[model samples]
Target: KKVSEFIGKTTNNVAEYTALLRGLELSKEFNADEIEIKCDSKLMVNQLKKKWKVKSPNLKPLYQKVRLLLSAYRKVNLIHVPRSIIKAADKLVNKAINSSLDKDVEVHFVEEETESTLF
Candidate 1:
């Protein structure tokens, strides 16, 4: 998040994007074989689904990455969740600078060899 500030990007929007990407990454780790993304940002939700075009250069790459990640999964969906229920993401977006959240990441896939249910 601090890096975004140094790069002259809106931390809120970047945090939102980071959260969305993290969700997609997690789905793959769970060996989900499918992915579903839920967000309160209508613009982001629609752009990833292609229901609307992304006119902002800032948002275009993120949208494209979501599409590519979706292809890696057997099935993927980008859906909207009402703001009332998306608490964690909201906090991430509205966090104060130098916040402790800098160490709290929701979706990371650095581990190797995930467990298999079939065993």
Candidate 2:
């Protein structure tokens, strides 16, 4: 499954963190024991992996939430990939943004498939 949510006027880091949090939630709901998380945001990935410090006060709570959710899984791999590798997600984000702007309402898109991959 793929999901996109329109959160208004937030910084890029906050958006990245929010996406991770949502992904973790979905994984938990599905009772997934192991998951691989891939994102184009290096800062978010590194922060989660403990390679870099989360210096922004705005991200502290988000970081903590992500960490808390992640503990339920038996194994989790956080990988940072180039943005080009995630064009489908980028398109969803653009769609969400456009829908929110045009309709003046919050946009949330969820596409389900027989085989699911969280994004």
Candidate 3:
């Protein structure tokens, strides 16, 4: 399974958490009893596994949300892997970023043309 989204401007930590949240939502929708989440973010993996504390105030809310989502599953495990191991996910993220940038450039070009026509 693969998923990607443009979550706008956010730190790497927030983006990682957003991905986790979305995956949990999808799992619940499908009524999945067990889920193994693999990611390249070691910090997030550790935080969720309770191996490390979530010290950032900005991340506290996201950490709490993850905990809430985990309660819905009969079994869940978060594993950390090297970035090279998650090629598909990395490609998806790059595709989404490029897609959004292309749209932004198109919008800027159209706005410039519209302004020119107004003169």
Candidate 4:
């Protein structure tokens, strides 16, 4: 699943949190019990993991929203990876930004599976 949104100008951390919020919302829609989130922002990762405090007033509400959404899941793992690993996502973000340069727009692209398979 992939989602892209143009949320206007904002801090990078806010954008990271917004992306996580969108991903969590999608997972909830699918009734997923467990999820693994990969992000390139170390600050966001650490904040979610509770290893670092959310000092910014602007992020407190977003942090609270994340916590509220996370409570619905049985298990959630947050991982921090290098930006290089997420080049495709970056491209999607760029595409969304370029497309919404003149207007406010949010785009979501979900790849659906044709069949369910048991492992």
Candidate 5:
């Protein structure tokens, strides 16, 4: 499953945390017992794993929230990976960013019976 949204102006770290939160929520919904989270952000990975202290005031709460989410799973692993290995997620982020910038694009859905009318 994939999820994306415009979360307004925020730092890259904040955006990454938002994605993590959504992913965690979805995993719980899918009844996943074990989850392995791979992230390109070193700071985020370290903070979530308690390897590094959360020094940023803005990220402290987010870090705590992630820790709480981790407790819900039976087993969870947080891994830090290089950006090259995370290309697919990168593309999703890029697509979301580009779509947000191009507000002029419009999409409409039509009923199957009226397909000819849409044309």
Candidate 6:
């Protein structure tokens, strides 16, 4: 797992995309065959799905980067989640404003051997 934080002075939509881009980079670093992206921002989710058009120039490039990253995944699942379930990405945005909250920014490598039977 790899995480990155981008901060300060940007529109909500742009910040959402920046977080998303970083997420994608992390996914790739993790060697994910498929990706499940969860975001609390409805506008960002809608924009990625073409349900909403991006009119701001600041968002256009980010949108394109997202599109490109998505293309690399064999299967991509983008989900609109409640803020309650999206603390990590939310923290990324806040980390930009204040660096102290950026603990989630990490590059982790975990190897899975097999399934476990806890029952």
Model 1, C-alpha of 44: deviation from truth (Å): 1.0
TM-score on alpha carbons, each prediction: 0.65, 0.79, 0.76, 0.79, 0.78, 0.72
- Residue range 44-85, candidate 6, lDDT tens digits: 877877878989899999999988988877776766667755
Cα lDDT listed for each candidate: 0.56, 0.73, 0.69, 0.72, 0.69, 0.67
Off by over 4 Å in 1: 1-11, 96-101, 105-119
Model 4, C-alpha of 76: deviation from truth (Å): 0.7
RMSD (Cα, Å) of candidate 5?
Answer: 13.5
11-77: candidate 1 lDDT, tens digit per residue? 4555566666765666665767766555677666666656789887877787678677777776665
Model 3's alpha-carbon lDDT is 0.69
User: How much is the lDDT of residue 90 in candidate 1?
Assistant: 51
RMSD of each: 8.9, 6.5, 15.7, 7.2, 13.5, 8.0
* Pairs that clash in candidate 1: none
lDDT of 2 by residue, 16-89 (tens): 89878887887777888888776778788778878799999999999999988988877886666677766666
Worst 10 residues of 4 by lDDT: 110-119
Tens-digit per-residue lDDT, 1-119, candidate 3? 45667878778898889878877877776887777667788788778777799999989999999889887777776556677656656666666565654221110111111110100
For model 3, state the Cα shift of residue 49 in Å. Answer: 1.0
Counting clashing residue pairs in each candidate, in order, gives 0, 0, 0, 0, 0, 1
Give candidate 3's total backbone clashes. Answer: 0
Clashing pairs in 2: none
Higher-TM-score candidate among 2 and 5? 2
lDDT of 4 by residue, 1-119 (tens): 55677887788889889878987888877887777677778888778778799999999999999988988777776666667766666776677566654333353323321221111
Ordered list by lDDT, greatest first: 2, 4, 5, 3, 6, 1
Candidate 5, residue 59: how far the Cα is off, in Å: 0.9
